[model samples]
Target: MTTTLAKDPAQAAARHAAPGQKRVTRRPNWVAGTASWIWLAIVIVPIYWIVITSFKAQSDYYAENPLAPPSNPTLANYQLVIESDFVRYFMNSVIVTVGAVVPAVAVSFMAAYAIVRSGRGRFLRYTNSMFLMGLAIPHQATIIPIYLIIIKLGLYDTPMALILPSIAFSIPLSVLVLSNFIRDVPKELFESMRLDGASELGTLWNLALPLTRPAVVTVTIYNALTIWNGFLLPLILTQSPEQRTLPLALWTFQGQYSVNVPAVLASVVLTTLPILVIYVVGRRQLLAGLTAGFGK
Candidate 1:
């Protein structure tokens, strides 16, 4: 009986309970639930409004209540945006993003590998310090100097003007993130590869690259988004209508006194769709890369 009572405490408690005793369960926190729903609504409402407004005619959009669904939804806004130079602007954005992000990731990964693998060399340490310092400098502060340098190099108003500055700015953050991720890789694996007569490049390519892929993907997506949506660089650097990116192209829809609100919003929606797709595809990797090394 003692053994039975010891093995089944619930049964024993039930058997010995006084009359009218009842189990009490913890209640769900309704306040927290309500707050979560409120926050979700705050976020979701704007996105819903943008999507719905994109379908409304400009006349209807201004005439009807802002939050009300369009009585006669139309695709004219999308048609107008597509009929413009949207495709050319889109291609320019793609070229600049790819041109910047690829080289930035490669160079940053290599630099990060060296910083992690090289043991306290003065130059490497100084280089790492310079990278960290870059994070403190605001882009606006350097725009004038960058503009002058671009003119000196005769790259002003060219896609290379945008690409070079983007790569330069992206490097510091990329190195920081990649170096941290690389530091988490087992030193034993690197040692084994070295013992097997693999060169440093081989080990970096074969070992570090594979292990740090998530961080690479994260930084690539991040840099892509930054360069894609970058307005200041394109605005200050490029001059011609042909050189304009999507962000700049939206200005074409605005007249002196009035704005084509639906067409402008339509441009925004189209521009954002690619970014949304990229995030959805790589979100898991991004979360993993960010969370890695936190426990240590």
Candidate 2:
């Protein structure tokens, strides 16, 4: 005969517990729940006001309370905005965003890859330092110099003026993000690719690019948003109405004596929609990319 050890009392209790039963957690704090609701209302109220105000007529907007729902919602503001140079400004924005973001992300990815994989070459180290230094330089500080350069280069008063500066400013942040993500990629994968007779570019194309796609998408979206809403660069670099981006187009709603507040809001809503859509679509990838190296 053999002796058996006694089961732990807790174990016995757990074993006797009914199948499929789950332990109940304490209820969330009422204070936290109330705070969350309050915060949500704070955020949503303004957005609701904007969307509702965008639909109100000029007469109704002045007649009714600022926060009240529109008694007679009208598309006249949107229609007026569309009939103006809104489409041209919209296209200019799209062109600038695409032109700037694509090249910025591509160049940043390659530069970051070099900085990460080249291990500590003097040039790479210096380049990385330069990018870090760029982060410290504010756009305001460079505007005068950039304006002069644009004039010298004959890029002034053109979409290229906006695109080039946007791309340049965007690169520093993009490289910072991408290089961090690239650094997190396992060295073993690179080594394996090397052993299989892959060139550096081959490994980057076959392995690194695919793995770093989330980061790429994140950077792209980030840069796109920045360039899309960018006001100063467009304001200073370009003068022609045809070259104006959406932010500049809002100027049309202002007059010497009166401002078209509802029309301006409508234009704002339209300008914001594309960027909002981009963020909503890429939010998951953005969160994942940003958090890629946190575990270690």
Candidate 3:
């Protein structure tokens, strides 16, 4: 009986346990948790204020205690925007953003593929230097020239003016990001594809592109956000209310006679929601791509 008890696994485990070997409770520290909640509140308070303000009456918004909860929240501001040119502004923004990002991604993918697969030469190196120089050229300095070109081309006050210039500016960084990712793809895979009679395009489309999904997602998200939020380019490029994008249209809400603060805030909320959604969805891929590119 004694030998059997001593040989029991559970008994042995309990008997040989080290002092203070109690199971560790994984509960979070209360003070640390409270501090985190406070930090979160600090971050979210302004956003919450904006959202609440968007629902409040202008009089309530300007009350002595502006942070106080709205006595009456209404959708009048949203209704006003929806009844007016908001839809047109939304469509214009969509058109320009889509037009820019799609072509930029396609062109960047091809450029990256060629640079990674093809043998490096003086011409390619020079071309790449020119691409990087684009980052150095401030948009303000080139805006005047771009405006002149737009007028000469008769694209003034058109979405094309906005789309084309954005695509041009976005391509360099897109190409650079894609090149780093493509370069990281195993050379053995490319060689094997070639041995199996795969052409360069086939290899890129079938092998390279699929492997760089994270990078593609990253670049697309970055470009989409930048294009969506762009102000100066759209302001100078588009003049007609019909051609006005969201950012430009939002400015109309701030008139000299009466500023509809709630309406303006509502418009801001609407404009930002899509970008927020895109970032949340693609955040992991974006971080991976950025880290990989920088590390490489």
Local distance difference test values of all predictions, in order: 0.91, 0.89, 0.85
Q: Tens digit of lDDT per residue, candidate 2, span 137-245?
A: 9999999999999999999999889989999999999999899888889999999999999999998889999999999999999899999989999889988788999
Stronger candidate by TM-score (1 vs 3): 1
How does candidate 1 fare on TM-score?
Answer: 0.89
List runs of model 2 lying over 4 Å from the truth.
Answer: 1-27, 255-258
Worst 10 residues of 3 by lDDT: 251-260
Error of 3 at 56 (Å): 1.2
What shift in Å separates residue 187 of candidate 3 from its native position after superposition? Answer: 0.7
lDDT of 1 by residue, 1-296 (tens): 35533458777788888888886668999999999999999999998898898999999988998889999999999998888878999999999999999999999999999999997999999999999999999999999999999999999999999999999999999999999889989899999999999999999999999999999999999999999889999999999989998787766555521466877778889999989998999999989887877787
Q: Score candidate 3 by TM-score against the native.
A: 0.84
The residue ranges of model 1 lying beyond 4 angstroms of the native Cα positions read 1-26, 255-258, 294-296
Candidate 3 structure lDDT:
0.85
- Could you estimate the TM-score for every candidate? 0.89, 0.89, 0.84
